[model samples]
Target: MEALKEVYSRSFFEQFVKVVKREYPPFDKNRFFELIYDQAWPDRELKMRIRHVADVLTQTLPPTYEEALGILMRIAPGCRGFEYLFLADFVELNGLSYYENSIKALEMFTVCASAEFAVRPFILKDPDRMMAQMLAWSTHQNEHLRRLASEGCRPRLPWGVSLQMFKADPGPILPILDNLKQDSSEYVRKSVANNLNDISKDHPELVLDISKRWYGHHPHTDWIVRHACRSLLKQGNPDALGLFGLGNAEGIDVRQLVTSTPQLKVGEDLIFSFHIQNLSNDARKLRIEYEIGFVKKNGSLSSKRFKLSEKMYPPGTSSVSKKHSFKPITTRVYYAGQHKLSVIINGREAALVPFDLMDGNP
Candidate 1:
């Protein structure tokens, strides 16, 4: 499979130059291209290339912020892919002197490529001013700008700088999330959930309070709350589980638990079978999951959970058969050692079953 980062190829740079020239006829496209594409251009990574493009824009465009922003605004309507993120990058690179212009540029540029990452520095430099702008943007007519309002202020945005200030005190972000919680756009709502999820990492009680206040208020808000509380649910937080109708699995029994092999080589599947009997008089809502205690090189177990099912179990028994592949992938490496598997129902764990992983030859 081709890498998504490879989208910032020479051809993308050429197209960006073409758009710049078409939007602003006076732009020196040749000089801009030359500055960005030197002898070692191919060797540069994606972000480095993006920074190079921003640098080239700084040199080729007018020195004044407004003039450069005007040129960027004109070219933004034609931008299609991740390459256009350079527009917001340029604003971050050069627009600190004129904060208002930079914010406006971000509002426009986000429609093409996300300005979420670009807005972080501004928020860090002057949180009060930038947060006020984000609050106003939460009501913007454009969904992208509205999404940026919440996403930009995330305490732990991936691939972007962490907002430590928010991590310490997330009170300020509540207003922005409140304004966007009922947003009509799923795009904006998902961003709000993600922003709240980020907050939940540091301030779980605050998120739970918000979830208590907001869950079931509206269908859209309910969905947002559920997604926002996903981490808490995985961690077996009682309130979060209850919010989703996943209560304690009363009178539940795990029986006939069996593994296909006690020992298997890496890159093979571990097939397991089990039966869950609901011995209760009333029906129970069960959240079934499994945890694999993978043995690490340092001889410690790292537990990884996978959701198996979330359904109602009547007064009877149901069988579950699962196959987990230990194929070598980029994200995780399997070490040959004794590992453990266990079942969890509605936040309760069962007795662990041990297994052994071996190298292929052994």
Candidate 2:
């Protein structure tokens, strides 16, 4: 697979230069290239490279911010996808002082590539005005702009800077979420759910209130509410579980929980099996999940949960077997040490088992 950073290759810049030169005749292609591919260029990661390109544009484009934004607005529609988000980042890097022009540029740029990250700084700069603009954007005719309305203001947006004020008091964000709850675009709706999910981490009751009110109103809204409460459900919050008809695990039993081996090596699979029986006289809903307590470098454990199944279990025994690979992935670093695996049924732990993880080829 091509590294994500490769999107800004020489070909991309060659094409981008052509696009900008058409909008602004004075665009200095040679200088832009010279400055962007500097000594530190290769060492820069994805976001650092994006900012480097933005900085280079500041030097190569028209002298003033407005002139540069004018060029950007004309060239933006031609630029599409997450790779072109440097256009929006350029706005965040240089357009804050331009205020109205910056907002206008963000509105235009988002049509092609999202201004989600760009808009957050503006929200922090002037909460009332920027949030009002965001509210207006919630009902935008374009799906990307509508999605930006929810995505930009997310309290804990991944990769984007955290909106600490919103995390503390997400009241300003609620109106925008409400407006986009029934959005026609699934992309926009997902952002609304994610925004609510971010808020749920800090203010669970507020999200629960919104969930209870919106869950049954519309199918789209229901989907948003269910997804928004995902974190709460994983944490075994009774209210969140109850909203989905997943109640106490009083009658659900884990007959046996066993791993293929107590000690396993990296790049190997930890096969496990268990039996579940329902003691309840009637059929009951169960949300089954597995928890892994991974050892950290400091010898502390960080618990991560993976959902296994959720279905109606009758008053009988059902067998389940699963294999968890210890394969290394970019998102998580695996440490070899004592680990714990637990079976969770209906938000309650039914069994806990220990295992040992060894280094490669052990």
lDDT of each: 0.87, 0.91
Worst window of 10 by summed lDDT in candidate 2: 21-30
**Taking the tens digit of each residue's C-alpha lDDT, what string does model 2 give over 245-314?**
9989997899889998789988889899999999889999999999999999898999999999999988
Instruction: Please report the candidate that would top TM-score against the real structure.
Output: 2
Q: After the best TM-score superposition of candidate 2, give how far the Cα of residue 91 lies from its true spot, in angstroms.
A: 1.1
Q: Which candidate is the best by lDDT?
A: 2
RMSD of each: 2.4, 1.2
- Per-candidate clashes, comma-separated: 0, 0
What TM-scores do the predictions have?
A: 0.91, 0.97
Residue 203 in candidate 1, Cα distance off native in Å: 1.1
Weakest lDDT window of 10 consecutive positions for candidate 1: 1-10
Candidate 1 runs further than 4 Å off: 24-48, 359-362
